[model samples]
Target chain A: MSELEIAGCSKYYKKNGEPMCALAETDLHVKNGRFVSIIGPSGCGKSTLFNIIAGLIRPSGGHVLLDGKDITQESGHVGYMLQKDLLLPWRSILDNVIIGLEIRGVSKKQARERALPMLKNYGLGGFEYDHPDALSGGMRQRAGLIRTLLYDKDVILLDEPFGALDAQTRMQMQNWLLDIWKDFKKTVLFVTHDIDEAIYLSDEIHVFTHRPGRIKATIEVDLPRPRSEKTLMNDRFLTLKKELLLMLREEQVSSN
Target chain B: MSDQLKDNEPFIEDPSVRTTKLRRRAFVGQVLVGVIILFLWEFLTRLGWLDSYYWSSPSTIVRTGWKAITQGTLLQDLAYTSGSTILGFVSGTAAGYILGLSFWWSELYSRIFEPYMIAFNAIPKLALAPVLVIMFGIGFDSKVVLAFLMTIIVAAIAACSGVQSVDRDLEKMLVSLGAKRRHVFMKVVVPTTIPWIVSILKINISLALAGTIVGEFISSRQGIGRMILYAGQVLNIDLVWVGVVALSLLSIVMYLGTVWLEHVLMKGRAPKS
Candidate 1:
C-alpha cells in the first residue's frame, strides 16, 4: 500500500485580483518505506507541493491521502525539515531535538532520555548541551535532522536538507542520511535542485517543471544498495547524471 | 623551549584576556577622569573662581549625604522611590507583554487599536502626572500609575515586533511536526521574544524611574525627587547635589540588576566572546 498519495492536487493564489497558478494538477504515490526525491528549477513550485503535502497549506483542489485516509488541510501528520536548519538559537541541542516530543506532551525528562542516544548516534553526543550558534553549519543541520526524526512520523519531508552545506559536508550528509533511512525504513520525500544528491539518495526521482509545476518525469534509480562515494564514479551513475542534467537543462531553457 | 614559549605568547592574547585588559584600563581611566574633575571642582571653589554657595564642592555634598544618612531620611526616601519604581516596572512590563502577545495573536484587534496605541505613546507620559496625582491623590499608587503609563508602550512595541519577526520557517517546521498552537507559542514564539523583552525591561527601568520622580516632583510627601525639590527650595546646594548623586546611584544599581538577569536568562545564547 502507498504510504502517501496526492491525487490531482493543485494550488492557485490570487494576486492583484488575478489568479496565479502555483501548482498544476499533480498526482504522486510513495510506496511504504521508500525514498523519493523531487528536483526542479529555482522558481518551480517544489516548495509549494511540499507545503501542501506537509499540510501547512491547503491544496486548491483534490485530496491528500495517508494509508487511504484523506488528510488534506490537516497538519502535524508528517515530519518536515526545511533548507535552513531552523534550530531555535535559544535552545540547547538536546532541548531543540526534544521539541517535537514536548509538543506531543511528553515529559521533558522522558523526551531527554529518548533523545540522548539519538544525539550520540548522530555525532552530536557531547555537544547536546551546546547552543546552536556553537555548532558548525553541518552540525546544525544534523541537529535539525534529529529534531525532525524525533517526531517519529511515518512520512518525512526533507526540503533540500543539505542545500547549504559545503560540497564535502553535503556528500558526507548524503551517506549519513542513507544509513539512517535504511535503518528506519520510513517513507521519505526529499526535495533538491542537486541532481547528484537526488541520484545518490533516492529510490525514485520526480522531476518538476517550472512555475505552475507538474511532474515532468519520474525516473527509477536502480543503483544497488550500500551505495557510497565509490558509486559516484560508477558507469551507471554517470549515465543517470547525464540523463537528469539534460532534462533539467531543457526545462531551465524553456522556462526562460 | 624558550623560542617556542615566545612564539606561543602572541597566540596567548585570546579574546578573553584582551577583553579583561581593556576593561581594566577603561575602569582606571574612568576613575582617573572622575577624580580629576572632582579635584578641579574643589580647587576652583576654594580659589573663589566659582561660587561655593551655588556650586557646592564634592566634599560638601558628601557631608550633606552623610548627615542625611545618619538622620535616616536618605534611606527612607531611597526605599520609597525604589519600591514604587519596582512595582510600576513589574506590573507595566507584565501587562504590556500580555497585550503585545494578544495583539500578535489577533491581527484584526491590533489593526483596530494601532492608531490609539501610537497616539498614546506619542504624548509625553509626564504630561499625565497632574491627572494621575488628582485621581490617586499623591500616594504610592499615583507614582506607579505614572510609571506604568511611561513604560507600557515601549514594552508592548518591542514584544509585538519580536513576535512578528520570529522565523517563519521555524514556525512551519513546528506545525509540520504535529505541534499544536500552544506548542508553537511556547517553543518558538516565547523564546524568540525573550531577548526583546529583556532589553525592554532594562530600558523600562530608567523610564519607570523617570515617571516616578516626575510624579514625586508634582506632588508627593516622600522619595528622592521630593528630597531634591525640598533642598532646592531651601537653597542648600550641597543637599541638592547629594540627592542627584543618590538618584544616579539608584539608576545604576537597577540597570546593573537588569543586565545580570539578562545574563542569567540568556546563558549559552549570549553573544560569543
Candidate 2:
C-alpha cells in the first residue's frame, strides 16, 4: 500500500472578484520510505500543495490519504521544514529542537534527555545551550531539520530547506541530509527549483508547470544510492540533468 | 628594512580599549559642561545681572535641599510619590496586558472595542485628573488612579500590537507540529510579546510618574508636586528649585533601572553579530 496519496487535490482563489486557479486537480503517490522531489518555476503553487499536504490549508477539491485512510484537512500528521531556518530566537538550541516533543505533552526534562544525544549525533553537542544567533547559517538549518525530525512523524516535507545557503554550504547540507534521510528512511517529499538538487536527492522527480501548476512530468531517477560529489560527473547524472532542464525551459517559454 | 616594516604596520587598537577611551572622554565633556553652566549661573546672579530672588542660585537651592533632607520632609515626600507611582504602574500594566490578551483571543471583542480604545487614547489624560481626584478623594488612591489611567492605554496598545505581530510562519510551524491553541499561546505568543512589554514598562515609568504628579498638583496633602506648588505660592524660590531637582533625580534613577531590566530580559534575544 502507498504510504501517502494526493487524489485530485486542487486550490482556487478570488482575484479582483474573479475565480483563479492556483493548483489544478493533482494526483501523487509516495511509497513508504522513498524520497520524491517536486521541481517547478517560481509562483507555481508548489508551496500551496505542500501547505495542503501539511494540513495548514484545505484543498478546494479532493483528499489526501495515509495508509489508505483519508487524512485531508487535518494537521499534525507530517513534519514540515520551511525555506528559512525558523528557529525561535529566544530558545536555546536544545530547547528549540525539542519543541515538537514538548507540544506532544512530553515533560521538558524527558524531552531534553531524548533530544541531547540527537543534538550530539547531529554535530551540535556542545552548543546546545547557545542561542540560535550564535550558530552559522548551515548550523541553524541543521537545528531546524533536527527539530522537524524529532517530531516523529512518518512523512517529512522539506520546502527548499537549503535555498538560502551559499553553494559550498548547500552541497555540505545535501550530503548531510542524505546521510540522515538514509538512516531514518522516512517518506520524504522535497520541493525545490534547483534541478541538480532534485536529481541528486530524489528517487523520482516531479516537474511542475508554471502558475496554475500541475504535474507536467514524473521521471524516475535510477542513479545508484550513496550518491556523492563523484555522482555529479556521472554520465547518467548529466543526461538526467539535461532532460529536466530542457523540460523546464520549454515550460518557461510556453508560459511567457 | 625593519624600520620600513615597523612604519608600514597597520594601526590597530583593542576594541575594549577604544570603547573605554571614548567613554572617559564623554564623561569629562559632560562634567565640564555641567561645571561651566553652574559657574555662569552663579556668576550672573552674583553680578546682579540675573534676578536672584525669582531665579534662586544653585547654592541656595542645594542648601534648601539639605535642610529638607535633614528635617525628613524630603524623604517623606519622595516615599509617598514613589509609592503611588509603583502601585499604579504595576496594577495598570497587569490589567492592560490582560485586556490586550483578551482582545487577541477574541476577534469579536477586538473589533467592537478597538475604535473606542483609539478614541479614548486620543483624549488628554491630564484633563481627567480632576474627575479622578473627585472620585477617589485627596488621598493616595486618587494619585494612583490617575497614574493607572495614564499608563494602561499605552500598555494595552503595545501589548495588542505585540501579540498581533508574531511571525506567521512560526505560527504555522507550531500548528503543524500538533500544537493546540494553548500551546501556541504559551510558547510563541507570550515570549514574542515580552520585548514589547519591557519597552512599554520603560515608557510607563515616566508616564505613571507624570500622572501621579498631575494628580498631586490638583489636590494632594503630600508629594513633590504639592511641595513645589506650596513653595511657589509662598514665594520660596529656593524650595521650589529643590523640589524640581529631586524630581529630576527620581526620573533619572527610574529610567536607568528600567534600562537595566531591559538588558536582563533581552540578553539572548539580541540580533546576530
DockQ, every prediction: 0.68, 0.64
Give the DockQ-based CAPRI class for model 1.
medium
Clash pairs of candidate 1? A76-B178
DockQ, candidate 1, comes to 0.68
Query: Where does model 2 sit among the CAPRI classes?
Result: medium
Interface RMSD of each: 2.2, 2.0
For model 1, residues B1-273, the per-residue Cα lDDT tens digits are 533566445645457767998999999999999999999999999999999998999889888899999984999999999999988988898888877777767779989987887888899989979998999988899999988888898888888888888888888888888877788888888878878888788889999999999999999999999999998998888999999999999999999988898898677673741
Q: In angstroms, how far off is B113's CA in candidate 1?
A: 1.5
Question: Candidate 2: misplaced stretches above 4 Å?
Answer: B1-13, B271-273
lDDT by residue (tens digit), candidate 2, B1-273: 422446668866568877988999999999999999999898899889999998788888888999999984998998899899888888888788877776767788899999988988999999999988999999999999988988898888888899888888898999999988888888988888888888798889999999999999999999999999999899888899999999988888888878887788677674531
Candidate lDDT values, in order: 0.90, 0.91
